[model samples]
Target: MGRAWILCKKMFSLTLVFNALLTIACCVGILAGFYWYYSGWNPFAPYLVNGNLLWFAIAAAAINIFPSALLGRKLHTGRFLFHHYFYGFLVMASAVIYVVLFTSVPLTTIFLVNNTSPEVNVGRFFLLGGLTLLLDDLPDVSKRIESGLNHIKAGANRMRKVIVAAQVVTGAFSLYIFAAVCAAMLTIPEWVTPANLILVFTVLITGVTAFIFVKRKAWNNLIVNGEENSH
Candidate 1:
């Protein structure tokens, strides 16, 4: 069982790296497409410009770059927590922005005129990719839980306990957001509803709470010394 677990970890890491490469390749392809469009060297230049592929490319690049960077290394506790909170914010913000745009504009008319346009498709693709990446990192989540438990067993400091609690809450909420977004995508119009808005806000609050706890050294002090000590 131990060997199997190790193999699974290895495979998961490889998968993350592979996804990162694919995202980078997509970014490069988008840039190349733009170059061709601007240079008028490609016959599809006009179509590319009309389809708003550039924006899709930019969005794809922006969304995927962090995950790529994150997967490029072995997961560390601090870095992993930071990644989750930061990526959670991005996902939440993007969902909110998308909802606003989707409701305010006549997206149907735009899609009708450019059925093959990459704009809409790209956002969906990126969101799916981000969710997939997060799900793939579940093993790391388990590792974190185990580590936290070990810390408690070792008589962890108050700050450590708080951090662990925050980690669990933040991680669970992040997973919820991932699942919610996936479900939302399957529905018609793919807009964020009030429930979705609530979920995003909750995630934001959880992340901010975790950040505050992480940033403050006051929580690290126990009653033993009556003085704060840096962890």
Candidate 2:
């Protein structure tokens, strides 16, 4: 009775809306940015439409809605809260400020500061946003944030074989996230150009998407199945 009640309550709650609006945007931005870059090399190149993509992914990831969901989950589960989200915010804030105010070191303009060049400055906000997800992982203290894919794995198996197959496929998306980011991260940030902008955007968005995807998926399971802990 208790389990059923919890599931029913969460199923149609604002949680689902918040999940899509706030958290999924993180992943969608990453996917879209990768799509922009992958109009050739990646598999989905031919399938997705072209977008005059903007650079708001970094800011959205930094905003409280994104981290509040991730860190809020950690806090609820008795994990280290302050270091992860607070530092995450600071990293993103620094990224925004640097990109807006100090992307190029005027004192060292002779080094290389070509906006038209594909090689970005490499060390500014373009690179800094990568640290948010890295810091979010408090692995020494616990598993840190629980995985959403694992929750699907723990779903009811006795009901049907199809459900098990679905679980496997769903959990596999995590690999897609990893592979997509690896493709982006491997691209050396050397100049400031459209492609380079997208690359840095990809790196930062990956961190945000990965963190939120894990947290949002797990919470979704809790809402839909009332199964918080995976067996």
Among these predictions, the greatest TM-score belongs to 2
Q: 1-231 in candidate 1: lDDT tens per residue?
A: 765664555455535433433433333343444455345443123322332332332332233322333332233323434444356346645744663475343433321221223455444444544454444343344556535544542464544565455444553443344344445544534445443343344333333433443445323532322211110
Per residue, candidate 2 scores C-alpha lDDT tens digits across 37-125 of 34443422222122222223322333323333333333323224453445545665665555556545442331223242323344333
- What lDDT is obtained when candidate 1 is compared to the true structure? 0.39
Score every model by TM-score: 0.24, 0.27
Off by over 4 Å in 2: 1-82, 104-231
* Residue-pair clash count for candidate 2: 6
lDDT of each: 0.39, 0.37
Candidate 1: segments with Cα more than 4 A from true spot:
36-38, 41-231
